[model samples]
Target: MSETTEKDLYAVLGASPSDPVQELRRRYQQLALQYHPDRLGNECSSEAESGVKKFLEVDAAWRLLSDQSTRRQYDLQRRARELKQDWPVDSTVCLDDMTWDEDDCVYTHSCRCGGRFSITEEELEEETQRKQEDVGEKEKEEEQHREAVVCCDTCSLSVYVIKDVKS
Candidate 1:
């Protein structure tokens, strides 16, 4: 629903992920002014069109990042993207495929890269909470509790395990 569905807001505004709210606002204002269609009214049609598009993108990014709730959601999605990029998920495994370690209280699956993908109960519970908060009630009713991906710490490998419903 947010305009930042595809592009990274921070990148679009030329700000860091950890940038302060004031800094983000300042950057957005500058970019908005630079790319405003009205400011380039006398420019060539092609250039004006490009400027309009960029202006819209900048406005959308600011809209999503300026709101606290939307910003939190965006941050969560961004973090997930970064994690996936770093780990490069290699395979999917069901809960049955994993070996449960009682002492460590985690489910572990072996990775092809000589590492292991593990998920703890706490992580599963946290993920469930996040999902419930993210989706609408109607959507939640239609969706079943799904699997979670766990990444290997030592290598670019990962696995998906059906999160324990009881947890």
Candidate 2:
């Protein structure tokens, strides 16, 4: 019923958007360290509270986006937001993937695509494995080609092209 802006978690954490997972965690730790209330003195209670709030937000965002399933749900939410931005007149599409966990204050997506058209995390992993196997096979073929040289008799020129093309 209500909508919120899909924030860039990296922006929240004040880190580079393109940072790797390790880098992201490191950045979040650094920022969290800076905002930690234990380090704050009595002189700046308001500032400390604000910092803590921001740090919590950053940490929460990072936690959500770091995990595969949660990140996917967030991504879907972000895509929906982008669509809304592009077409202001269009009604909001219900992406009922997220369900709030009361204690954690985080949303857990109930990733049910319905009927036989479901795309589960297991399916994604299988697909990824398939792709990796395909890549490995292609790489092996390339390595074999690299070891063997092809010389053109007409030009007396030898060239090694990794890309197999029908000429």
Once fitted onto the true fold, the runs of candidate 1 whose alpha carbons sit more than 4 angstroms away are: 1-4, 73-89, 92-103, 122-146, 162-167
Return the top candidate by lDDT: 1
lDDT of 2 by residue, 125-152 (tens): 4434443454697664444211112233
Model 2 lowest lDDT segment of ten: 86-95
Itemize residue pairs with steric clashes in candidate 2.
Answer: none
CA-lDDT, candidates in order: 0.79, 0.50
> In model 1, which residue pairs have backbone atoms overlapping below 3 Å?
none
Q: Model 2, stretches more than 4 Å misplaced? A: 1-6, 16-18, 42-44, 86-167
Cα lDDT of model 1 by residue, 116-166, tens digit:
888887786676656666677878676555656677967866766664444
**Distance from true location, Cα of 82 in model 1, Å:** 8.8
